[model samples]
Target: MALLEVHDLVVEFPTRRGVLTAVDEISLHIDEGEVLGVVGESGAGKSMTGNAIIGLLEPPGRIARGEILLDGRRIDNLPYDQMRTIRGKEIGAIFQDPLTSLNPLYTVGEQLVETIQTHTDMTPTQARARALELLIEVGIPAPERRVDQYPHQFSGGMRQRVVIALALCVNPRLIVADEPTTALDVSIQAQIIALLKRLCSEHGTAVMLVTHDMGVIAETADRVAVMYAGRIAEVGPVKQVVKRARHPYTHGLMGSIPVIGHDADRLTQIEGAMPRLTDIPTGCAFNPRCPQATDRCLRDRPEPMPTEDGQVACWLFEKEAAHV
Candidate 1:
């Protein structure tokens, strides 16, 4: 069974004007020790999906429909207290800004020990030793001494490493990492990504990595899900989606990536901006920006249909499937 399953999830917000759907019916899964990259433009609901899975959606924003299951057990309906316990124990979370995720007031050791103790039956001494080991595992130098330092003491990259350590302290089965490298230097981003890949592989931890950087996804993920305007445009193995995208939106996203040796006057770009949640158009949310959009695309939303090796939600694919 898939380690993590998100089925037909619809995240909505109750606004004074009307209800706004931030995430439409989207589904995906991740297996143990695999990285599933969720990539899209900003405001594409990548982070929102991660937050929903980790039970961290702010007030007014809620899962209006569908379900989230971890290890074949429904967690979307679990009470706040139960879900709180599950957060650090069953599922870990790493956010874009390490500074925001880590408490500046507490020593790194204190935080890691607390998280470890909460989920495991380890004594304080054992938890502290584990915390130090985790810091070393994540490549923090001299973890024995660094463990007692505050968040402010570490460099940006080192602080992120600490956040990653805290996330893994409880030995969670899955992790929801939302833009975990966005706040770091370009050089540091690669190191952090490598660290996550190595540690998760060693521990057999599944990852839901949410980001806007296609390069990061290409490097770290086994599979990729391309989201656009709150819906999944395409999903498949990382190699296929990166090299042979089917949906126009996914194609545009891949094209927008700057190739190292290629010379161009300007990078390829999609014509229109993502729709605002309050003003999402009828039918396929991507129709307004899709170059291959048809009348059917503007009038009727398409469900995910099988493609060469993955799935794409597009009327064009549906018609092609019909002929087959």
Candidate 2:
């Protein structure tokens, strides 16, 4: 069975104007030890999906509909205390900003030890040793001394490593890494991605990586799901999705990539901006920016249809033309 299965998840925010649907009936699955990359621009609902799964969405935003299943058990409806028990034990999360996730007042060692002790039956000494070991494994220098320092003392990259160590404290079965490298420099970004991939492989942890960088998805993901507006526009194997993109939005993204020999006056860009959650169009959400959009696209929403190599939610690949 898949380690995590999200079915028809919908999260909405109540506004003075009306209810805005940030995520609409989105569903996906991650199997044990597999890396599923959820890629899209900002406001694409990727992070919202992660937050919903971890039960971290605050007031104003709520789960309008859906099921978050972990190992065949439904978790979305669990009580607060029961869900708290699962949050760190069954699932771990690493966000874009390490400092925001880590407590400023506490020593890094204290937070890590607290997490380890909360989820496991380890004694204080054992937890302390494990915490130090994890900090070193994540590439933090002077694991012994550094552990005693506060979050502000570490560099951005070093702090992020500590965050990774904290997430792995419970030996979670699933890891939700929501743009974990977004706040770092390019040089440090690669290192963070490598660390996540290596640790997941070593611990047999399933990962759902939400990011805007296609390069990161191509490099770290076994499979890719592209979200447009609030719904999935395309999904399939990473290689097939990257090299043989079927959705117009996906094609536009690839066209913008700076290739070695391709010399163009300007980098190709998707012509328009994504619609606001409050002003989503009548039919296909991407029709306004999609080059291949037709009248049918603006008049009727196209369901996700199977392509030869992938699945895309666009009229360009209508089933009537598939046989021909």
Candidate 3:
């Protein structure tokens, strides 16, 4: 069975304007030791999906309907304190900015030790040793010295590595990484991606990687889910989704990625912006931005139907003959 399953999740915000649906009946899963990349442009609900899974939805936002399961057990409905325990023990989260996950008041070792001690039964001395090991494992220079330093002491890249160390300290079954490499430079981003892939592979941990960069998803994810305005446009293996995108939105996204050797006058651009939650378009949320959208696309929403190798939520692929 998949390690994490998000079934028809609906996250909404009660606002003065009206109820805004941030996540609209989106469902996906991450298998054991596999990385499922959730990719989209801003306002596509990728980060919201990740936040919902880790139970970090902002106060005003709440799960209006649906469920999130971890290892066949429902976690979305658990009490805050109960979910908190599960979040640390069964699932870990890595955010785009490392500082948000780290405390400036605490030494790197202290924070690591605290999380370790909170989730596990390790002694203070034992937790410290584990923290040191984690620092070394994440490639922090001078693990002994750096462990005693504050979060501000590390460079952006090193601080990210430290956050990674904390996330993995408990060896949780899954990690929800929301734009985990965004703040770092290109080289450091590659390193962090490689580190996440290698570590997850080595330790048999599943990951839900949420990012707007299709390039990063192409590198680190085993499977890709392309989200569009709070819904999944397409979901399949990385190569399939990247090379043979079925949904127009997915195709537009793939075409926008510049290939190093292939020259083009300019990258493909999807003309329209994703709709705001309060003003999502009818039928297909991406219809306005989809170049190949039809009359049916503007009036009839297409549920995810089977593709040759995956699933796509587009009327163009509604029939078997449409499979490429």
Candidate 4:
């Protein structure tokens, strides 16, 4: 069974400008031990999608439509008190900013112990020991000594590891890591990715990884979902989406990446900037920038349609033979 399922989820914010849709009819699933990558440019709603799933979407932003199911149980729109039991216990979140997520006033050990104890029946000493073990498991040095350190004392990478450790404290079936490596260096980025992959494989943990880096998605994701202007343009297995991308937006993203073997003087780039959330185009959101866009694309929105490989929400892939 799929560990996590998000169906037709829409997140919108009411601003002075207008009702800005940050995530529009987005849907996907993650199987046990599977890593699903959500990639797009800034403001494409990748992080917002993560926030919605974990019941952490900030004020002014509300889930206007659709459902979020974890292990076949509905979680979207649940009361805050009810959702608290699920968050960190059933579905953990490793946010983009580790520093901001950690409590500066508490030691790493205290936070972890509190988390574990609050969710489980473990005694204080037992929780502390488990916290130490988790720290070491996530690659922290001298787990015994480091567990007592404050968030400010740890380096960027170490802090990220601590965050990971806290996320795993409850043995959550699913983990939503929204750009968890964004604060670390390139070398440390790889390490964190590897650690996440290893943990998922070992524990049957499903992951929803939100990032703007296509390379990171290529290396870590079992499946890829490409979002543009708050909607998913394409979704499929990693190999299919990366090598045989059907959507023009997905193609543009792959073209922009620099491969070790493929040489180019300058990286290919997608033209035009992201339209304001309050001012999304009339038909297809990506139509203004899509090279293959036609008059029909501007006149009418294309519904998400299934293809042989996966799914795409573009009219260019409408013909029966186009996807074959």
Candidate 5:
């Protein structure tokens, strides 16, 4: 069975003007040890999906419909206290900024030991040893000394490694990593990506990696889900989606990425911006920006239809296939 499942999930916000749907009927899954990348521009609801899964959605924004399941059991309806127990123990989260995720007041060792103790019956000594081992596991040098230091003492990359260690304190079955590498430079980003991939392979931990950077997705994710204006435009294996995207939105996204051997002087650029929540297009949310959009695309929203690799929500999949 899939490690995590999200079925027809909808996240909405109650506004003074009216209710705004931030995530519209999104559905996807991730298997054990698989990294499912949710990629899109800002406001595409990728991070919102992760937050919903992790039960961290800001107040006033809520799951209006559908369900989230983990290990074949429904988790969306789980009581707050019960879900709290499950979070660090069963599902971990790594965010974009390590600074916000880590507490500055406490030593890194204190935080890790607390988490370990919370989920296990280990003694303080045991927990501290475990914490040190975790720091070393995450590639923190001088874990002996660094463990006692506050979050501020570490570099951006090293602090992110600490966050990774904290997330894996109990060896959670899955992790919802939301833009985990955006705060770092290209080299640091690659290092974190490698670390995540290595962890998944070693520990069989599934990942829901949400990001706007296609480059990260290409490197880290096994499957790719392309979202536009809160809806999934396409989802498939990383290789297929990256090389033979079926939906125009996915195609545009793939085209925008720089290729190693390609001689193109300019990267492909999508013509328009993502639509605002207040003014999403009537049919496909991407119709306004999609160059191949047709009358049907502008008039009727398409649900996910089967593609060779996975599924795509587009009326032009036929033409796309022909082009392919």
Candidate 6:
């Protein structure tokens, strides 16, 4: 069974103006020990999807429709307190900024030990020991001494490592990591990616890695889901999606990446910005900006259709399938 399953999820905010749908009928799944990268532009609902899955969607923004399941059990409709218990124990989360997640007043050890104790039946002393072990596992040097320090004492990279440790403290089956490396320096970003990959592999934990950085997705994710205007444009194995993208948007994203040896006069860019949630275009959300869009694309939305190796939500693909 899939470790994490999201089916037709729709997240929305009812404001004075009107209801704004931030996420629109998106569905995907992550298997055991798999890294599913949700990549897109800033407002592409990547973080919102993660928040919905982890039961952290802020007030006014909620799961308007559809279901979220973890290990075959439905979780989207669970009560707040019940979902809280499931959050840290069954599904962990690592966000973009470590400082925002960590408490400034407490020692790192205190926070880790508290989380471990809350989820497990371990004593204070046992929890402390496990906390230290986690610190070491995340590659924090001098964990014995570092564990006693506050969040402010660690560097950006090290603090992120601490956050990773906190997420894994309860041995969660799945993790929702939203731009975990975005706040670090480029050099540190690579290290953190390697660390996350190694730790997840060793623990056999599934990860829903949400980011806008295609480079990071290429490096760490097993499969890639390209989202556009709060919908999935294409999804498949990372290599296939990266090298032979079937959807035009995915192709544009891959083309935008800079090559080391190949120097081009200018990098490829997808024309026009993503439409605002309130102003989403009719029919295919991407039709306004899609170069290959036809009259049908402007009037009718296309659901994800099977491709040779994956699925693409495009009329072009649908027509091709019909001819075949």
Candidate 6 local distance difference test against the native: 0.92
Candidate 6 lDDT for residue 82? 97
The per-residue C-alpha lDDT of model 5 at residue 253 equals 83
Work out the TM-score per prediction: 0.97, 0.97, 0.97, 0.97, 0.97, 0.98
- Candidate 1 least-lDDT 10 residues: 315-324
Task: TM-score for candidate 6, please give it.
Answer: 0.98
**Model 4 lDDT tens row, 69-136:** 88899999789999999999988999888778899999999999999998999989899989988997
lDDT of 4: 0.90
lDDT of 2: 0.91
lDDT of 5 by residue, 1-324 (tens): 998999999999999999999999999999988999999999999999999999889989999999999999999988899999999888999999986779999999999999999999999999999999999899999999999999998889999999999999999999999999998988889999999889877999999999999888888889999999999989999999988888888888888888898899999999979999999989888888889888998999988877767889998775554443
Instruction: Candidate 4: give the clashing pairs.
Output: none
Quickly count the clashes in candidate 3: 0
180-277: candidate 1 lDDT, tens digit per residue: 99999999999999999988999999999999999999999999999988899899999999998888898899889999999988999989799998
**Candidate 1: stretches off by over 4 Å:** 322-324
lDDT of each: 0.91, 0.91, 0.89, 0.90, 0.91, 0.92
Off by over 4 Å in 3: 321-324
Clashes of each: 0, 0, 0, 0, 0, 0
Off by over 4 Å in 4: 321-324
TM-score of 4: 0.97
Best by lDDT: 6
**1-324: candidate 2 lDDT, tens digit per residue:** 888999999999999999999999888889899999999889999999999999998789999999999999999989999999998899999999875878999999999999999999999999999999999889898889999999999989889999999999888999999999999999999999999999999999999999999999999999999998999999889998899888899998878887778788899999989999989997899988987789998999977777765578888878633753
